[model samples]
Target: MPPYPTGSWMPVALSADLPAGTVMPAQSPAGPVALWRTRSGRAAAFADRCPHRGMRLSHGFVRGETLACIYHGWSYAEAGNCQRIPAHPALTPPDTIRVATQHVEDGGGIIWISVGEPAAGPPRFEGLAPLRSMVAEAGIAALEAAAGTKAAGGLLDYTHDDRAVQLLLAPDGQARTLMHVLVDEDSNPDERIAASRAAEALRRAAEDIARAGIAR
Candidate 1:
């Protein structure tokens, strides 16, 4: 497997994991982010830290369309501009009082965030749909060792019980990886369950390999 690109789209979270009017903490190459979706179903990513008191915005709540910091109740819009300051109800927040945001793409049942300006959108798996996401204590090398194959284009293929499962890998750091399990769109319930369990088993194997200092 090649090294994870520094200026590419990283799959941060599964779309189903972040529903409308919700926020979740996600990892990006740049750092941590608060991935959120509005009531109207628009997805956005912002720097996890609130500018007010540096509180993690992921600890905040989502209003109708804006994310409000739980600390001072400062609400910010989808564009990352501060929209409201609860303490001064009559005052409009200045443009400078805003959180930093990243480019977000919601496609193929995945939420991808760019670390820098990318010339194209995220890669799409045409006939596959996301099953679930899990964090592995191992790195990509261990994953490749466990699966007996390398990941290409951020996707690793694993087969079990004659069923094909795709694993999307995003390196969380030097030692951790975020794994998203994907199966064929036409997969039945049993296939989906098997795929999920296979992924869990793969994760365990990879972590064990990493703990033994075998994957480098």
Candidate 2:
């Protein structure tokens, strides 16, 4: 299987994992990102580093519709503009004091971030719904070896116990991968559980293969 396009939309997290008024650390092709959702439920992604004190923005908290740096209370808007500086409340913050932002899309129960300017939106699987996400200590080659199949367009199809499950992969660093499991939208609870387990098993097998240096 070919690697996912580095400049295209990459699935960073499941939509359900990021609730309103929360921030989480995520990986993008550019680097680490502070993926967050405002109280009004808008998803946004910003450079994880804070301009002031060099703190991680993902460790910050959300207030109203803004994300505030945890170290010195520097607040930033969803558009990456600096809104407030606690030490200089009487003075307006300069527009230049802002974190770099990236394009974000929330669709089909997934959250995607673009590392570069994408000509179109993220890929959509019409009848599949996301089940869960897991981090594997292996690469795409190991996954393909375990599943006996290749991935195309960042998606791999695996069959377990006569049931079909889709795996969406996002490479994280050299040998780590983030896998998102998807099942039919109309699947029952039992089937969903089974699929989740199957994915876990696959992850273990792939990791083993990677550790043994046998993945191709």
Candidate 3:
């Protein structure tokens, strides 16, 4: 249902895609998450459930530094603590009334989320920059078969017309996969465009292979 599980950090989205003071809905192995950022440009994720009345927190709005449930205007801090309750403005929310949080790491131009304690930080590609991301109607096996290479250290190596590309992949439970394209950090506009196109073509090929049930 999500990018990562218990001990590993998986790249969920690019850092640029999520702006400050915004919340996006996502699924996780643990549960649904409201991936959000604060006004000051910090990223955090909360269990997408509002313990108050079973509302989805992802449908909530972001305040100065808190996420407020759209239903009753109950606000929660990044740490998942209840910050304010509009109905009881004078009452401090008890510690038991709080949202659950996941481990989030924003680094290397990507956002990583982990369900439980992560063994380490997100993997870094020293000389690669994220170009774009897309979903492919294929499994990881199909992608690896099309690329003719196995994933190493969370990065899949592929060559497109003499240009090297690194693909960061997140596999959904079904046969779908989220592919994030990474290219040389020093690449020019034309090179970046080419790499992006290459990734698209690869996805098409992978999808075809998947449809034919040729990849194992």
Best by lDDT: 2
Number of the candidate with higher TM-score, 1 or 3: 1
Tens digits of per-residue lDDT, candidate 1, 64-132, equal: 999999999999999999999999999988899989999999998999998588888888999999999
Higher-scoring candidate on lDDT, 2 or 3? 2
1 versus 3: better lDDT goes to: 1
Question: What's each prediction's TM-score?
Answer: 0.94, 0.96, 0.89
Question: Residue-wise lDDT of candidate 3 within 2-22, one digit each (tens)?
Answer: 335568877778898889989
Screening candidate 1 with a backbone cut-off below 3 angstroms (N, C-alpha, C), the clashing residue pairs are: none
lDDT of 2 by residue, 1-216 (tens): 335565679999999999999999999988899999999999999999999889999999999999999999999999899999999899799999999999999999999998578888898999999999999999999998899999888898988777778999998888999999999999999999999999998899999999999434
What's the alpha carbon RMSD for model 3?
2.7
- Candidate 3 global CA lDDT score: 0.85
Top candidate when judged by TM-score against the true structure: 2
Would you list the rank order by lDDT, best first?
2, 1, 3
lDDT of each: 0.91, 0.92, 0.85
Per model, state how many residue pairs clash: 0, 0, 0
